[model samples]
Target: MTSTDHDTAPADRTAAGTAPAPAAPARRPRRELAAATVGSVVEAYDWTIYGILAPYFAEQLFPGSSPTAKLLAAYLGFALGFLVRPLGSVLIGRLTDTRGRRYGLTLTVSLIAVGSLLLAVVPGYASIGLAAPLLVVAARLVQGLSVGAENPSVAAYVTETAPGRHRYFYSAVSYGGVVLGSALSFIVLSVLLGVFGESGIENGAWRYGFLFGALLGLTALWIRRGAQESAVFTAAAPGADPAPGPDGAPGKPGGTGGTGPAGAKRAKAPSPWPVLRAHLRRLTVVFAITSGATTAFYFVTVDFPSYAEGTGAATKEESSAALLLGMVALLLAMLGGGRVADRFGALPVLRVGFAGLALGTVPLVLAMSSGRVPVQLVPAVLLFLLGLPLAVSNVFAGQLFPPAVRAVAVGLPTAVAISLFGGTFPMLAELLRSAGHNDWVPWWPAITAAAALAASWGVREHPLPGEPHA
Candidate 1:
């Protein structure tokens, strides 16, 4: 048969033989989206507050001859948190896939809350000696796991629940929550600095930030408790018949089981490892993209402020204010980027963003080093560039896998990438700067951005089952 005839045969036969099932409604559930966004906010707050407050709290928690050593030790603890993220992704991701999105989100938020509370109350080096840093590391480990699972679960939920036409726009909710949470952390830091002064913050006031994060985590948990499960997940649940796609094929299954021709019984759920192995190339694409994007993210949001302060390009208060302003810019950019992605397609938008990063990072870093540009404008511009690709990154990753393996598939590799590149950024940047190789710092993210730009080419857009391809 001719190519056109071959494609049309199935449609013609299905039209002639039986009535096709109506497509699932692409309704936007406000409550569920709100819960996901709130959870994301708390997750970001809990995870980022550590890095923000580390400089103030480092001396108290770590023993070292020099302030730089203490700060490095504290950042090591931060990296330790990222180290366990993959494990969290696997364990919590499995739970998410098996139990449901809402359940996974609630559990992650609870875990992060416990970690935050632990950080708030943990004894310092002066009080507890060796156990102090150990306890801090322990807290980080817990927070890491929660954060590892949290991002992917939230991404999957938002992707599955959103209307296909506006999926990219809705995807902004994930990063928007992150930007808000990061902005809130800076706001809290500014207030604490105002009230207690730098010396007071170093003395003990930093604990309050973690305490506040714990409180916010509890609030997120309450909100998530009321969240509705993703309808796509429900339709794909084991033993539930798959919905019909536009061409009358069986829709993608979630949780477990295999899809076949319409009306065929689904095969039993296979091992996730096999499923993951089958999709290894897709996972690599997620990893490459995440490596570039998250490295840039952590560099701008977590490390750049401290780097500026250390280099005397900006003072503590100045850097803090600049970072806060940058986060606000990022928040706005995320929404705008999502809209642009929806109109132009996510891959093209991602390519453009990463290309900007790959090309512009060095110039921005040089400008910051030169202390010529306004401190606030530099970070705001840098973060705004980062926000564009980040806006729809999680959604793009979510689309790469079927529902049954979406959480773990997206979570595991993304977590690993963050752990390697994003989590290590602060410590690595500090080390380079300390070694007087500060010139090399910008190249790190620039290289990663270039890699992401290349990987974007490999990422084909996969519309949700029953949704029209973009």
Candidate 2:
């Protein structure tokens, strides 16, 4: 028996009295993939837009501070937003796990749109004085909460809806959305810089960028409003599915006994704590598995450009160009990671991805630090690409839990790790670079990847605890 099944010695007998649910409709697997991608692109775009525009906004908002201190302050606000993610996970996770994925995802998209709008409209410090930075902090906090809910909801939906054969490829869209989002943002920034010049960008073009995010967030929200509810959760919810019939076949879809009042079953909203408690070890392992990923993504996508520019390794123009290159490589790595996971099993992909990071990150950082376009784009970029663990990570995490607590199960620890590591990535990278230890940058992800490798031994693809061995 699974740990959740066996651990309830004093079982919550409420579900025992309820009937099992009928078979659900054939899952629209592509809809799950599309909805997940659409919603997450907005989440990723909203979050990373800050990192892309940080250098400019830091000047606009925190005018008098030294460049390093300003970056530190901006990242501090970024980190502060992440600090609230655990709370968001608890709240949003419970909502999705209990109410429905559609509810949780829709809420997440709304928050993203609002957060982006806030940043778009909030006045600069020169006009509003102290309130300017405070407003930005508030905006980040909203965006942070949206992100906390977004990743797990997308992963959980993809996992539950996809057929076992194609789960990895579809689930990879979780991170693929991130890659696409950041890529779009960078491309926009490059165009703005080219057309408007630096002063124009800092003054007005940046506002337009956030406005674009706000509009996209609205589009995602509308799309997700119609997202198909999770069939697993639908069947599990109390009233939605009926008990088995006498012949051993289960009741018809949406319960048995026709539409009469006699067939009504109450929907039992799931509680998060017991589910998490039952799977604590798995939860811990999930956290470890994601630590390297969370750190590596933020490190390469968010921190690397600032580090290169700050260290005199590259000019602002060169750093942006290099980031564009790395993002393209990220897209390739995402595809490769998913394909590898589907063919070989997610564990092997996870191991290989982690191994690549552990072995090559230092050299990659060293090469990027030199700022030569060729050196940065060559095989060194491949190492960062390997760090695209979201595909493997999402697939692995999706199969590890049942749908009841899946969102929170995946989101809680992911939030904790990202809050701890991802949030601090830019600050830490900038701090280390400022301290003249540019070489140390690679070791952060290297250490995390090694730890994740050890943790991968504990991951399994089955919904049940031990039926299918890792």
User: TM-score, each model?
Assistant: 0.87, 0.86
In lDDT terms, how accurate is model 1? 0.81
Alpha-carbon deviation at 68 in model 2, angstroms: 3.5
Off by over 4 Å in 2: 1-26, 241-270, 367-373, 378-388, 460-470
Looking at model 2, residue 269 earns an lDDT score of 62
**lDDT of each residue in 277-306, candidate 1, tens digit only:** 989889999999999988888888887766
- lDDT tens digits, residue span 249-319, model 2: 22333333433225555544646688679888899888887788878777777776666666667666776
Compared with the true structure, model 1 gives a TM-score of 0.87
Residue 230, candidate 2: C-alpha displacement in angstroms = 1.4
Candidate 1 deviant stretches above 4 angstroms: 1-28, 240-269, 464-470
